[model samples]
Target: MKHFLIIAHKAHTADDFSLNDLPGSAGRMDILCRCVNSALFLSHDLRRDVQIHLLLLGEPDPGRVIKFDGETVRYLNPDERSSGSLIKKALDKDSSDFEIRSTPGVTVRDANLSTLLSEFKQQGCSLYYLLEDGKEIREETLPRGDMVFILGDHNGVTEEEEAEIEKAGAIKLNIGPISLHSDHCITILHNELDRREKEY
Candidate 1:
């Protein structure tokens, strides 16, 4: 399975924020919504083997993780609003750790990076940190394993967050010299990986 993890540093944790005005009180949630949309859709439909993790660190709660299961997830349409609504519903719940069964997928979790990384590690995933200055992503450079790509929101991952990710031994990868939005980066990654896999 392929996993894309995005860190939203100032994503609003409260449910009072307007979905239309994602950049205002929601703290640029539009960026995240775009990212989620990219991860879920390509040309026609969803990628069955893919998963997305959103690490929300904002208002009322700091470490909230929203996971999207493409394999068996249900009721998740091919639009940003569907994902955004589900995320909003998850945030409104009062529990720090909980799961919602939707679309044949029992998903959503509230956890920190440490716990999330640990789970991924146990699943035998090769973690890769997406950064501009890191090594360029290439077909030959890609390792053989369950891959997990970690990225940040509009402002990008903080220095401290990068440090922790680095400590976890995630190889840093740069898609290109020019900086790209997180969602664009994700689309590029999916396209590249899909092309390379079909080649082999």
Candidate 2:
């Protein structure tokens, strides 16, 4: 099964660049530099060909277009009439070939996590996060054998989350924060993919 892993940062989260402007965050030296970090992390312990997607969220907007780094970015442009048509149509979970386009190794500034998650699910992906809410994932959210990971925020759910995850039959693990370069992320991802990965 093709899977997409989402690394979410709320629109308000502090980073090195402006969160509202996509290119600034996507092109900034520190953010762009993370590409190597992500590559290392994802490629390290992964047993599958996993594609990581970095999703940035911010408040909804109308029809504002911003130009940066030789690319023109168009937002929802808050004033466009939807004819009552909802984004759900485009984010349908049943879509066979659906996909989400986000700036990799960078921050994505948007306001709706649910909308973003729906889009990812349409593309046959499941969300894995170390959130405090303890409900970013559900059994019915994805098929069995899917993997979800937790890092950084070990607020104490590591044990309890393991039980819930066991019940759903999803792989769960906690990797403490150890910042690495891009290639390092890839290295870590490959280790996770080793034949005896369960033993890691």
Candidate 3:
């Protein structure tokens, strides 16, 4: 199964509240990119040969993008439905093993989307908290296999989105940055990543 990374908030996840009137589509593209970059770096460091791709499928230029090693970022235009349609098409076209990698900050918001994207994969879509500095990613500390889902925030999700995911048989998770010291968000992030790693 091919893997796709869809992150919603590079910085938003840590905020006490959601951003107001932000361009919803593009706001989390950076979160998505960071997700891929973190996972790619983790795979590389661990010498895992899991090839992945990044598809920026949406409107308004499909958002501006930047590239990191071992990842490709592109903007895709899906007929009228945007991401939902485009991802469905990609699933049919690829017709191979695939899974989606996302961060809770984004994936949880649209759990139905996560459910749809998982259909094409041998394993279900996996989500993670990508915590790193600009220079490196620490994957050994990340949760693996089925444990990724539990690394999400315990509260604050909207009722509508939560209902959809719960109805879909997927569990909601969150990783809180609020409890950590400013210089230690990444530290707490690493610990949280490790916590799940061992939980499984």
The candidate that achieves the highest TM-score relative to the unseen native structure: 1
Tell me how many clashing residue pairs each candidate has: 1, 40, 11
Question: Number of the top candidate by lDDT?
Answer: 1
Task: Give lDDT per model, in order.
Answer: 0.80, 0.30, 0.31
Stretches off by above 4 angstroms in model 2 are 1-29, 40-48, 58-111, 119-127, 130-172, 176-186, 197-200
What's model 3's lDDT at 172? Answer: 31
Residues 1-200, model 3: lDDT tens digits: 12323322222221222223123433443333333433344322421322233333333223211212222322322112333222223322211223332221112122223444344233554543322211123333432543232111212234554454455554333334234322133234445555655677
Ranking the candidates on TM-score from highest down gives 1, 3, 2
Ranked by lDDT from best down, the candidates are 1, 3, 2
Question: What does the lDDT read for residue 122 in candidate 2?
Answer: 59
Error of 3 at 45 (Å): 1.9
lDDT of 1 by residue, 1-200 (tens): 89999999898876778767778888888788888788877566778888888888988778877778777766766566776677777676665576654335425557888888888888888999998788878733675569999999888888888888998889989888798999999999988888878877
- The 10-residue segment of model 3 with minimum total lDDT is 103-112
- Evaluated at residue 109, the lDDT of candidate 2 is 30
Each prediction's TM-score versus the true structure: 0.92, 0.34, 0.35
Flag the better candidate by TM-score, 1 or 2. Answer: 1
Off by over 4 Å in 1: 102-106
